[model samples]
Target: MSWRIHHVSLPTRDVRETAEFYTEVLGMAESSPPWKDQDRGEFDIDLAHVAWFQGENAQVHLSRHSRNFARDNNFHLDPIINGHVAIEVDDLDAVRERLRRKGVYFADPGNWALSGLDQIYVLDPALNAVEINSQLK
Candidate 1:
């Protein structure tokens, strides 16, 4: 399946500062998050604590760290605990099938963060969380 780095998420204590640093200092333009107006459903994220920056090919997501967000939401793998690299795959089902065959446990959050994204989380060998997602048609 075709795969590409969609975005890299970073946890910060202050979302506005981090966003300013990325935009003013790093020269990345601020981008609107897809979930801006959409309800998070059960994800329970504060939009005020999040920001997005656009790169040439990929994006950067900054979020305020919250220890309770994952546990409160009952997520097996916390996408923002530390941070995560989001990979966009051409076929999400194919990736899920491969993970199942390999006995890799994945947490399907299913578009909780972004609209039209079918997302799942997996831990890498180093125990770092990784997000695999595909755009829904």
Candidate 2:
């Protein structure tokens, strides 16, 4: 399956400040999050606590850390805990099956963060979280 880096999420105490740094200092344009107006009933995160910035083909997501959200959702892999790099794959199911065959533990959170996108989180050897996702057909 083909895959590419979709975005890099960074946890921050202040989303606005971090967003400003990315946009003003880094010359990245502010981008609207796809889940901004969607009904995030399944996720406990508040939209106000997040920001998005775009740089060419990839994006940077700034999120205010919410430990309660992860704990409440009982997510095995917390995507926002220390931040994560998202990879968009052509076939999410294929990737999932591969992970299963490799005996890699991953958290399947589906579309908890964005509409029309199925997402799963896994950890690298260094214990850094990585998000694998695909656009829903």
Candidate 3:
């Protein structure tokens, strides 16, 4: 079957914060009304509600916590020690500084540069890793 990946859902403790992270830190555009319709609740999906944000090439759907879940469901959601989402930017340092000023903690000031690219890794409010990189000449 032919298919296109319109969006990718990222689970977070706070949908609003996650949406802001994508928009403010990564430069993604938050959708108006900030509401999205998904077939999740109908099929008893794992998420509560999803918010949509537009990136340069693709769209991102931020999943929020639902009432169906219980407090002991920690195992189902653990952002730390897991792989992160990487995004490319024109100015890595500037983005890094912006995130820092927003009280974000970067794993390092700047990681190694390879193949003419500068990189810095950071985490969102939910502890999801975010790699911000720049294409260097």
Candidate 4:
């Protein structure tokens, strides 16, 4: 499956401040709606607030916290990292099958709390969290 960059998500202590920094220093403008809360139970995550900043070609998501974060993710560790990048693909089913067959290690694809896109979490070799999302048609 051909992969295209979607966005990068960063877990920060303060979402507003992080967005401000990106907007003021990096010149990223708020692309999506204002920050809001999330209500999903996947990966033991309960995001309180999230915001997205738009750059010239990509997007950045900032979140305050995730309650009950994943404890046994691919790296067998809680996602204590930042700048989690995302990739979008049209054929999610094929990608899932390929990843499963190769034993590449990934999570079950599920709809996000607010954004109903189907997404799966996969960790890179360095244990960096990567979100693979798709809005299946």
- Which candidate comes out best when scored by TM-score? 1
Residue-wise C-alpha lDDT for candidate 3, range 1-137, written one tens digit per residue: 12233334467777677767777898777673222222232222232344566766656666664554433332333322343465767666678678779986665424342234465666677777665656655
Q: Write model 2 residue lDDT over 1-137, tens digit each, in one string.
A: 68899999999998888878877898878776777235644443454688887777788888887768667777876788799999999999999999999999999978767768899999999999999999988
For candidate 3, what is the TM-score? 0.38
Q: Which ten residues in a row have the lowest lDDT in candidate 1?
A: 36-45
User: lDDT scores for all predictions?
Assistant: 0.84, 0.83, 0.53, 0.66
Order of the predicted models by lDDT, top scorer first: 1, 2, 4, 3
Clashing pairs in 3: none
Question: Can you write out model 1's per-residue Cα lDDT over 61-134, one digit (the tens) per residue?
Answer: 99887778778767876888799999999999998999999999999978766778889999988999999999
Supply the TM-score for candidate 4: 0.71
Model 1 global lDDT (CA atoms, 0 to 1): 0.84
Report how far off residue 92 is in candidate 1 (Å).
1.0
Candidate 4 lDDT over residue span 1-137, tens digit each: 67878777778887777778988998767765322133333332323366666666567778765444554333343433565788888878887898899889887636643365777778888879877878746
TM-score of each: 0.88, 0.86, 0.38, 0.71
Model 3 error, position 54 (Å): 23
The candidate scoring highest on lDDT is 1
Better of 1 and 3 by lDDT: 1
